[model samples]
Structure formats: C-alpha cells, structure tokens
Target: MKNMRDKNSTNSGFTCANCGRTVSPAAKTARNHCPFCLWSLHVDSVVPGDRAADCRGKMEPVALFQKRDEWTVIHRCEKCGKELPNKCAPDDSFEALLNLTALQQ
Candidate 1:
C-alpha cells in the first residue's frame, strides 16, 4: 500500500522553511526532515531517501514513534493522498508526539 520510489534521490539542496537551514542529498544524508525542527520540505516519494515521485506535496508529521529498535515518524500530505513512515531525527519534536497521542484519544 506504500508508493515507493525505486530510484535514488535526484534532487539535492534546498532552504529549509522550518528553520532556515540548507539541505542537500548526500550518500550519508539519512535525514528527511529538518534536524533543527520536525518540519520538512515537500520532497521525496512515500518512503524517505527516494526522490522518484512528482507529487511535490508538503509532508507534515502526524505521528511519532521509537519502536522495536527503530525511530520513525508518520507523515501525511494535504495536497496528496500519500502517507508513509520516515526516519525521525534526535531533534524531532517531542511535543508533536504528545499532540498525536492526545489527538488519538
């Protein structure tokens, strides 16, 4: 049910809107969202690290998780029907996780 890209990232470098940071696709660039903040630019396919889709949808973190020896966050785009799991950075929003849990209940 996940629309994943089979190719590597083709686009690199952008001014991050969340925290005024610059990002570029790199071999070890495992970050999909801003490390300074949880907000992310509209990029990538359903899965992070792949840039094979043309949706150009703004991804917003709706849920957070650090489960089963893994760290992941759930993203949903308002412009598109794409939803997928992305890797969460250590600087991710703890408040966002709380908000998600509160909304779930």
Candidate 2:
C-alpha cells in the first residue's frame, strides 16, 4: 500500500479498472486500467493508491453515480468489498453503462 496517493491525498489514479481508457499519470505514478475492458488488476496494495498491492484484483463495475458534473463509476472487488471511483471511457458500452445508471436512478 505504499505510494498509494498523489501528494499523499488518499492516493488515486486516472485509469482504474473500471475505465479501460488509456490515461496519463500526473507525473510518475501508476496509471490503473486495462485500456480495453476496463477491468482492473487486483492491486490491493494501497486501498486506492500505489502499486504496492500484491492482490492484482479484477475490479468489476458494480454501480454508477450522477454527480453535479461528473459520472463516477463505482467498482467493487470481485473477491472483496473495496470500492473505488473511475472515469468513464469513450469506448465504454453505451447500453451497459446506461443500464447501470438507470438502476442507480
């Protein structure tokens, strides 16, 4: 769970398992994402930051949120209860994504 945060702020990443988009890290931190299916590797090393985790988990999209300005994707571990936020990808399935949002609403 080391190096889990950018600026030590609860650690975060741009391309997490939920958003398979290719992303640019702010600097040198690890960018999390599969760049295809948006499935995350079980990286339970930091709760949400750092590549220190050995879990290398497969993060599955479970929920969605319609914030004032952003639509955050909530992902739950296939093996754990941990959750994280993910930015939507352009290639994300519109139908599936809409269904997820519909259920949330």
Candidate 3:
C-alpha cells in the first residue's frame, strides 16, 4: 500500500479548470481551489491534501458561509454532486466572494 503520510504531498500550483487561470499555492495552507474563481476539483476523498478521489470533476462555487471571522466557500461537484467546503485564501478575489455571499442571501 501507498504511504498515507507521505511528505511528498506538495502544495503545487495548478491551472484553474473553470477559469483557465494560472494559480499559485497558498502561503499558509494547501490550496485546493483556485483563488481567482474560487473553483475546485473533486480530488480529495475524505480529507484535505489526500488525493484519494477518482471523481476528477469540476467543483463549482455554490455558496459562502462564515464562522466567526473566517469565511469558507462551498463547492459542489458538477459530475458527482458532492459538496465540500474550503477556507477562503488570502489572495482569493474579494469581489467573487462577495458575489457568492450575495447569492446566498
């Protein structure tokens, strides 16, 4: 079996699947979504940074929610219909987050 706690799990940059923008890795945490469009991929099965999923679907930013001071973006998979929440990155577009927040209200 493969090592589950491998240190080789890198926080690498990737091209946005939804917006086609080049995304850089986050400074404090593993970036699972695009900071430009706030879109993500269904790559993790149960936890963050665990690339154990095989869905490979485009995750659409559906809603925004807050817990105290921090905000999170809820992404829904287009192919598998799974919903996941990712914390907002510092470099994420404030305008886009506002738009999602407005839509939720």
Candidate 4:
C-alpha cells in the first residue's frame, strides 16, 4: 500500500502551525499551506505533495509574484533555508496576500 504521506494521498486537513487555524484541504487542489498565514511545513523535497522531505521545518511565507493571472506565494524553510513557491488557492486570505505584497514593495 502507498503511504498516506505520498503525493497522491496528501490532500488532508491540518492545523496551521503559524496562526493556529484549523485549515481544510483545498476544494480543487491539494492544500499545502495555511490559507490564513500562508505558512507551510517543509514536507516535500522535490515536488509538491511528494512528502519526501525529512527537514520538517516551518516554511515561512516571504514573497509573492504573479504570472499571468495566477499568483504564487514564496515560502522559505526556517530550518534549512530552502525556498519554494506555491500557487495561491481560491480561498486564500486576501489580507495575508496583501501584506506580503506590501513587504515586497
């Protein structure tokens, strides 16, 4: 059997480590970060949902960018300093995204 942490089975709800919010999985995509704080755990090493990483660090949202109409959130691992970008979900907090944008400007 495949592990629950594997790429195909990682779409599950989790509590936000940064904001303490009880987050639900995304409706159309696999939820990887806290929508409220835009924080994530460093669980994937190569690809999103892979769960192959062993660092298990807190990924902090540090930047934001846009490509066409989609917005992406950049997260940096606090423990290892690895950075990754994730696409914004439909339900992600607009206020949090705005804060990131302000910091970039």
Q: Which structure among the candidates has the greatest lDDT?
A: 4
lDDT of 4 by residue, 4-59 (tens): 34555788888887888988878888888999999999988988877888998999
Encode model 3's per-residue lDDT on 10-105: one tens digit a residue: 477788889999887688888889988899988887886777788979999999989999988989999999998888888999989988988888
Candidate 1 overall Cα lDDT vs. reference?
0.61
Q: Please give the lDDT score at residue 32 for candidate 1.
A: 70
Which candidate wins on TM-score?
A: 4
Give the per-residue lDDT of model 1 (tens digit) for 1-105: 022232443434455565676654444546676554455645666556666567766677677777888777777776785777877655556776667667657
lDDT string, candidate 2, 1-105, tens digits:
333343444224445445545444434333354434546655645544445555556777678776787666776677766777765654455776777767777
Candidate 3 Cα misplacement greater than 4 A, ranges: 1-7
> What is the full ranking by TM-score, best candidate first?
4, 3, 1, 2
Q: How far is 35's C-alpha from truth in model 4 (Å)?
A: 0.5
Q: Looking at candidate 4, what is the lDDT of residue 17?
A: 79
Q: How many backbone clashes does candidate 2 have?
A: 12
Clash totals, every prediction: 0, 12, 0, 0
> Against the correct fold, how does model 4 do in TM-score?
0.91
Off by over 4 Å in 4: 1-8
- lDDT, ranked from best to worst: 4, 3, 1, 2
Q: What residue pairs clash in candidate 3, if any at all?
A: none
